[model samples]
Target chain A: MTGPARVPPAAPAASTAPAASTASTAADVDGDVGLHHLRLYVAGQTPKSLAAIANLKKVCEEHLAGRYDIEVIDLMENPKLAAGDQILAIPTLVRRLPAPLKRIIGDLSNTERVLVGLDIRAKAAAP
Target chain B: MPIKPAPFRPSLPKTPTGVAGFDEITMGGLPTGRPSLVCGATGSGKTLFAATFLVNGAVKYGEPGVFMSFEERAEDLAANVASLGYDLEALVAEGRLGIDHVHIARNEIEETGEYDLEGLFVRLGFAVDQIGAKRVVLDTLESLFSSLSDEAVLRAELRRLFSWIKARGLTAIITGEQGEGRFTRHGLEEYVSDCVVLLDNRVQDQVTTRRLRVVKYRGSAHGTNEYPFLINDHGISVLPVTGASLSYSVSDEVMSSGVGGIDAMLGKGGFFRGSSVLLSGLAGTGKTTFAATFADAACTRGERCLFFVFEESAEQICRNARSVGLDLQRHVESGLLRFEAARPSLYGLEMHLARIHRDLDAFRPAVVVVDPISAFRGPDLEVYAALLRMVDLLKSRRITGLFTSLRGDGGLQDAEDQGLSSLMDSWIKLQTVEANGEMNRTLYIIKSRGMSHSNQVREYVMSGTGIGLIEPYIGPGGVLTGSARITQVAREEAMQLHRRQKAERRQQALERRRAALERQIAEMRASLETEEEEAAGWLREEELRELVLKQDREVLASRRSAAE
Candidate 1:
């Protein structure tokens, strides 16, 4: 049974401008390309959670350009969402788009690990 | 530069494991509100220890427990513990325990995306909440590594898992497989855990011993040496090598030694009640018989006695004693005397002590007799330490104990060298004295601490009527026994016979002299009678010649005399 209700993220990421530019460029190039559906689960507005959100936006903008969408699921408000994603550690990012799903645990600060874990690019050498 | 010590904090509140000796060794139990790692090699009783902890917590300590097995199923775990007298299903049904089997077959599921162990956490949380459990056991926690492809994630998640339990304030024992030079396979759990307990199964001389050592415990003191643990129907228990403290209550009362005449030599009574007596003797020196006498005395007094025979079977002991008129069967039939006979080599000293303790707990006997205690074959120190602990345990209970040891050719001195004599409150030595081409059994009281006892060696006879101790057979030359004693007694009796014969000869001579004297007197009397007759005849003839002249005078005289 799903325990507790779903709630929206407490705040939106400040790096939305870069993600919008990247998404528009990618959308203009590939007509009706599928959008990346991403969910970031965090316990609260802790530093680790905020850092995860910022890092995910940065990664999406740089890698997926404008063809990605991010959903921040705060476990503090909707802990039952953790059960849906099988989240045990906090600041976990799950990719729910482009067929097979992928999960990256811990803060998304390690760009190489986050990209490699999500299988975005084989050995995505950090620039 | 001098290294600065870490700030020490008070020890964490412990959640008692309830498994025997764990509390005592760990100083209070497992580190509470945190994950403690129990790592061991294969067949080292890791799972059993964890299960016993959970079961004992639920049943013994009145605290509910949740057992989440990553390897075995709930039914399998339950069935396994059923042999240990733990009814897991019943406890589960009664809401005292929750056993959740987390199955992770490599082929069943695919790890396609990012996943945490939220499912396991939820189920564990549900189980704990269901029973209001204060303790949780994750058997073989390393099994989760097989299902995951991400090592870094698994390591981080495990760390998080440990801290998560700490945050929830629930004590947990996470079991793992041991690796070379590492307590666990991953070697990372110990770093995250608050404590690490290592269980080892070692085999030497075809004898397997399971030992437990507390490798690390944060903010607490723990036993450093490896302690042998035992698993049986009664459950798992660890044997602490050191015995109880010497400062214990002592019973002043005395009890009989049970041998025919041994009690008189043990002092006013025999050994003190609650005292431990060691009987060291060579082969065929009546050690078992002496032990039987102790048992008999207790049984006759209506006090329960427990006889632990290591070499002989109960039937054999009973039959052998009956031949010596010990009559142990009647005590057995009456239910006052109990015999537990087994080969001590069948198990380690810990298991033997565990079984003895179990029986003692059930029987509550006033006296315990361990016949041939040295039968616990092992290192001399091991056997001696085990015996010391046993004596300590019985002494603490204020129960009289009689322990017999098979002394070697070195005899009492050799047995005493093992430190057993010092541990005993009373010590008796029995030996075979070879004299006059015969072996005689003799016993002596070596020492009885705090009590006056006889120091003289007493020769004893073991017959159908049981053991009889006589004063040592001392003679003119030296101490003689057996046929030598018989010869001395016979020699003295012969000298007595010669003196009586001499007196009889003198009395016969006196009787002959008296007979002769009587015969002589009879002859003299007869001859005198004949002579008197002759004299009378002669006188008559003379009177006849004068009668012619005297006849008239005689007639006249006769007439005058008649008238007169």
Candidate 2:
């Protein structure tokens, strides 16, 4: 069951932005190309939860530009949503778009880990 | 003989070996319907761990188990785990478990022909059927190997036995004493089994560390590391060593070292909390003094402490403390400290463990001091296993454990004692150095778990008041002995006092000299002033020099005549 397409489509850099611009031009075309419709599942203001959010914001702004929309979902406030995602491990991140939806577990710091897990670099190669 | 009825074989369920940590290591219990192999060296807790598993299953878990022993009888097994808090009687009475002691006498039971495990299997099957048993334990399968000389028959029967356990869908734990380089003597039984657990009972430097390592688990991701397991009143407690690194956070809190100068030398001014320190030295190197000082500090901080005296009685301990100027009696009387004195040979390794477990449970002390764990060493490896369990137990409670090991003839660098050494979080070697013909006791903290302890051996002296750790002996031929340390410290103290006296004398002489110099300067200035006035008068009289000169001469001659 697919959810609503609240996340915006990838930035239309396919026609304009060159392949060489993947690293440098990623900052210029900063509109939901890299991690959009991202959902952060957490449970209250635990150190892990706070760290997860802080790490995500730092990572997103630095890498994903202002175009990415991060949905902070508190399981304590909405425990029912836990059933939909098979969330055994807490502080899980669900990358909705960039199809074949990847789920990255744990408080996603360790910059290189987040970069590789989110599959953002593959977006620039789309025809 | 014609009227003799067939022998009665009652229904029985397979028995479970209720070893405490063993079950946990197996995960959801040993293959619920298969015979698994438990192999270890002599006194590696192979039989004890296995029997405890069965007894625990029956007595605690309410799952009836049958234990068929080829070695020790029912009473022996019961008595062993009795210290471990497993009451085998209640379980037997409640019709839950059955203990069948099958003594296969080598001389008595003759193997006249090709023997089969069918007779033993029949006996076990009968026991299982009678109790509706869910678990079974066959201890030391080596006994069968010893009984039956043919390896081929033993292998066939063991394989058949494994199949019978599986076919019957009963969980079974079979134990065998480990052979050199082999998991079990009768290989196919343990080989075809679902799990293999290896137990090691090793002793080094008189401290025994019993470790359980899961060599293989077919379908589960068990803790593959050598987990330290303790067999006490409640049975085996496995200290999971796998995920230890993930749990630590660095902190900068300087805890007092219970002694003055020692703390001052430490940049942070103290040891860290949850740090294990070892004070190892020769018999007279004052290792106990260090432990007492630590206990004093812990007790003073309102944190409860446990002192396990191995070599001395509690009263003797108090007396020893008095000699060293540490009054532990007050703390003990005040209930802030608990002093436990027991000979290392007072009980089996497990009994010692049970006492420690019970004491820690009752007192809930923050610090535990095992004064001279080296006393637990024996010709056997059981002591080492017990020591390891004790260490693991302390670590789990996060108790700052201080263990004093008495290093005898061999110095602290003996690799032969690495069993206990590896388990230690921190190691301190105390050496009595003979420095400049005087006995000096120096303490060198060889290792500290999570903090950097002093490497240099500092001189220490205990007087009427308390332990006085002084500056490290600098002018030393090498490390000083105990007698030399005392003499060296006295000489150094005397030298310091002499230096102070000399300094005082120097200061007094300098003060007197300064006062005299000031007086001289004042007088010289006054004389110059008088001379200047006279010169001014002379300059004024220069015009009338002849007249002034004649008057001056007349005045001078009058003054001279008056004086005459």
List runs of model 1 lying over 4 Å from the truth: A1-127, B1-11, B241-243, B410-418, B497-564
Classify candidate 2 by CAPRI docking class.
Answer: incorrect
lDDT of 2: 0.68
TM-score for each model = 0.73, 0.50
- Candidate 1 lDDT by residue in tens digits, B93-162: 9999988777554433334334455545666777787789889998877887886666777777777778
Per-residue lDDT of candidate 1, residues A1-127 (tens digit): 1211222233233334554555455445555434666778776677777887888899888987765667888765664454445554566676654334566666688877777665566524533
Give the per-residue lDDT digits (tens) of candidate 2, residues B150-227.
578677767777888889887777887777678876564354557788888766555566788888767655567776
- Please, what is the whole-model Cα lDDT of each candidate in the order they appear? 0.77, 0.68
* TM-score of model 1 (first chain only): 0.69
Task: Supply fnat for every model shown.
Answer: 0.04, 0.00
Least lDDT summed over 10 consecutive residues: which range in candidate 2 chain B? B1-10
Question: Largest lDDT belongs to which candidate?
Answer: 1
- Residue-level lDDT for B419 in candidate 2: 65
lDDT of 2 by residue, A39-108 (tens): 7767677676788788879877777665467877776665545434433235667655444345565577
